[model samples]
Target: MLVAAAVCPCPPLLVPAVAAGAASELADARTACSDALAVLAASRPDRLVVIGPAEEGARGVHPAGAAGSFAGFGVDLTVRLGSGPGGERALPASLAVGAWLLDHTDWADAPIEGLGVGTELQPARCAEAGREIGASAERVALLVMGDGSACRTVKAPGYLDERAEGFDAAVGHALGTADPAALLALDPELAQALQAAGRAPWQVLAGAAEGTGLEGRLLYEDAPYGVGYFVAAWS
Candidate 1:
């Protein structure tokens, strides 16, 4: 069996909207996550894991309650990081979305696991985990959440400056700003590097709200600040 995992960064504010926006733009993200999960589940792999930040803070990580599950989607169980705070045990928004997907799908009754540890969201650690999980499964897909900057920070070998530039450009276009050139003036070196990486800024920007099919303006208008960097990848 092949197992696939997708990771996405999520802020705390969107938690309430999972059920509230069952039919809105937020549903786009939900569908994307569920699609990935369904793919993994269909592969019938040994395990399918989804990684993300803690919802409340960045101290620890944990899984969501049983109320969350994705039925027909390809998830047998969900393992979440514990709370990042002192002693609070809460899952991150990314993982919460995963759990919620599982709950909403046919696999709602599937077993969900929680893995809590005090660790930083570094690339080495995440990659290491990805490798470990991959080793055990016949086939693996990893969807990393977050944009170039966030992914670069966590994934190590930081993203090339070119990628960052592309992201900035996309952001500028999405924002309808006439002078994204100012970004170049502010961070010339970074801009040059992003340009060199050959990264697709528009793709990174689009990925955030890819499944939603909503225009960038509408999604960005409602998304919380700093949420744009959240990304997902499969390996």
Candidate 2:
């Protein structure tokens, strides 16, 4: 099974300014989150699920052991969108990388899950947690990070209800069909404050999914500031 889904709206503010020194903005968000986690550990996926949006109803899955050596890429699930205690914080860096993978790995004995977050955009808890981990998995890849009004307010309202001009073709067909890469590590004064708060929909869904097959790439590196990385592969 190979799955890598990453979405970011904040929380990699250069890893809390490199643990709070702000050395040149933590060396440009640690060189763009180490080149997007070295292209997500070069597509070596065993299990790494991280969904977004959380403020109070914090939900976190287990197994966070070897994130360094990539020991089986453990860290099953953690989906806490919003709506219970508080909401609207969208993707706070996916809850600061799910609280830095539950305070630096070990998954807390693994196996912890929950889902809610509903009010406007209803992905129904991210498509029922992506079809319950894609029905026992063999291949699953979904890296979604807020934009386009946090993915058209979280989709699922019978697909395309929010209708922000078809929110990037409805979030590239509900974050599937693979082939999406949009990296813009803002720094030019936060990319002119996100183009004066236009909130570029990841460059308009990577230029309308280009050739139409839905493979897109846009990396404007100023260095990984507010962190964004999505790598998925399943076999």
Best by TM-score: 1
Candidate 2, residues 96-147: lDDT per residue as tens digits? 4444433432231223222212212222333334455534445333233333
lDDT score of model 2? 0.32
Clashes of 2: 17
Each model's Cα RMSD = 12.5, 18.1
Off by over 4 Å in 1: 7-23, 55-88, 108-121, 137-226, 229-235
Worst 10 residues of 2 by lDDT: 64-73
TM-score of 2: 0.24
* Predicted candidate 1 versus true structure: per-residue lDDT over 66-104, tens digit per residue: 222322233443433222122244444345555554555
The TM-scores, one per candidate, come to 0.45, 0.24
Q: Give Cα distance to truth, residue 112, candidate 2, Å.
A: 22
